[model samples]
Target: MTYSTENTLLYVEDLSVSYGDKTVIKDINFVEKDVIRTGNVTGQVIAFVGRSGRGKSTLFRALTGLVKPSSGKVLIADTTTGIDNDAKVVNEGDIGFVDQKYTLFRNKTVSQALMFALRNKEITKEEKEVKIKEYLHQWGLEKVKDQYPNELSGGQRQRTAIIEQIFCSGHYMVLDEPFSGLDVGNIQDVKDAFNLMTASHEFNTIIYSTHDIELAVELADSIYVIGYPSIEGKLADYGTIVKHIDMKEIGLAWKDFGLDHMEVVKQIKAAMLSS
Candidate 1:
């Protein structure tokens, strides 16, 4: 599975976040490029795995610009300009974030919520309606288009939240513990939503965090482990990226899960435990 990369889709350098006197995460860095594969549309699915109390949630907040970092910066491709390495500092609204709760408008029906997501777009009302319809159909939410958030199932609500982000934002999405609390069937539904998003565009990137190491290995092409680092033979209090694994480089990406994946899962679990 040979693939080439184009422009940098996401870039982070020396990023650190602190709250008051406590430094949560520090010295975080990573880069993800727009993957180009022959005869296939490739999108990035990056996962972060670590023990609880690690800074995964804080990192996600900074990535989505919900919280400001105390140091360093995050940059994503300037889609407003062009795809020619024109980078811009990430700000609020630059990326969409979907949390575990899958929050939605209680009063708005699925169709209405989707339409509201497109309110800032330059397209006309008819065009927006068409786009919403397409997404609802594609995500298998067409039958529930008229349903409100309270009326939908957990999976349906999650899918609607995901689609809302897609329409409101663009290619970049950050999901914080998306698989949390989901049953097996609902988990598959969310997985299907991930596939649909990636298949729809080449630059569509999904960055997520999970405790399930096997699922991280199975779904993500790239995985990062965040944990407290040791310095001078003593463990530090701050969390940072301790390890990164490229599934593509190891011939595990986009392949069926097997013994190889299980081994990687074990490795990740060990990393989490030690850190």
Candidate 2:
């Protein structure tokens, strides 16, 4: 598959996060551009994989503007400005974040929760209702539209959480350990949700972290391995990006999982173990 990049969709430069005296992530930098493919809408799925305590969560928090970076900036396409070259520093609520727990409003039904997510939209109530209904149907949550979070299954709740984010934020979304603690069936459900997002919008970018190397290789078009950097033959204390694998460049992205993908998985595992 051949594709070309247009305007920048996301840019992170010299991003570092610190908690008081401790620096968690340092000198992290990456950029993702709008992937243009003829006769197809191609969104980006970027994955971060590393050993535990490698600051993946901290990186995600900064990306979503939950936590401010001590140095550098995160920038995204400025859709609000309507200028193609305009970009904005990411702010809180600019990007939706869905943690592993799939948190939701306990008191709100699936339909009501979706309505709340659209509160800031300029659309009328009737329009919002129509949109919510459309999303519920499309996400396979129509049957549970009136049910509260407590009454829904894990997959249903996860879908609701994701849809809420899509309605609240714009194209950028950060999911921390989304596939963790999920069964095979539930994992498939999440993967389907990812497909739904990417298919719906060309600039819809999903940034996620996971320990599952094979799943990351299978789902992400670009993969970043975050780990301790080596200096003078010794590992540094601060975590940073050690290796970046572009599945698209390697002819592994958007393809069925096979020996090639397994090979990439092994490469990722080796990077993780050494760092």
Candidate 3:
């Protein structure tokens, strides 16, 4: 416990996933052990950086409880007790996930989807409308509010999905390849939303998956380099801690360290390619 002042928000110990005979992921041991300051750790975001088809999506599914892990432990650190509790204790309401696949009610409009996300709130009808309107404006979906998911462009649809998930999510906001399928404008919106949510204490764990190492380094406080699972004539490998580069510690306040960052990115890519 003395290792880090930051409270452990999540712990994945010896985690593995399988579909009958084929193992998708194995032995993912991850923990946040740094003694980060409270302000720096509360909204900490982590990225699982790896190539596609490397079980990033599968691991995300297991983390969100969509699929059960074949072996090992998945724990959520309790804030009060500082205990890493079992995964069984996690409920659907505990985490909000923005999936890689897109799904929408073909019959409903973007406005309807936003309202649906807030259906459980005890607020009045007037409050719901106001909240929906605010979100539409904030997410650049005001013009497409009445448009069905199919009618909207790729960027609009992605914005709608992200805004809905953010509104519905409680503690953790786990996004699978959020940067994918987004335009420059929409990507900026999603990035701003992540920063806002973390700063406002809307979500504790803002984790995502991406193959772009540069984007991962620019965003996440920590990175988990997921290794490609083994096949025929290949050595078995799972998720390993390739490197833990703290962005806050990467650059100094007195000097310009932009070039230093570029070097780190290159080093990370080298490690990934070698892995």
Winner by lDDT between candidate 3 and candidate 2: 2
Clashing pairs in 2: none
The all-Cα superposition gives candidate 2 an RMSD in Å to the true structure of 1.0
Clashing pairs in 3: none
Which candidate, 2 or 3, has the higher TM-score? 2
lDDT of 2 at 179: 86
- What CA root-mean-square deviation does each model show from the true structure? 1.0, 1.0, 4.3
Model 2 scores worst on lDDT over the 10 consecutive residues at 79-88
**After superposing candidate 2, which stretches have Cα over 4 Å from the reference?**
none
Per-residue lDDT over 1-275 for candidate 1, one digit per residue giving the tens place of the 0 to 100 score: 89878999999999999999999999999999998889998899999999898899999999999999999999999977764999999999889899766689999999999999999999999999999988888889999999999899888988998988988898999999999888999999999988988888998999999988888999999999999998888889999988899999898899999999999998898888878
Using lDDT as the yardstick, the better of models 1 and 3 is: 1
Model 3 alpha-carbon miss at residue 193, Å: 2.1
Candidate 1: RMSD to truth: 1.0
Q: Lowest lDDT 10-mer window, candidate 3?
A: 248-257
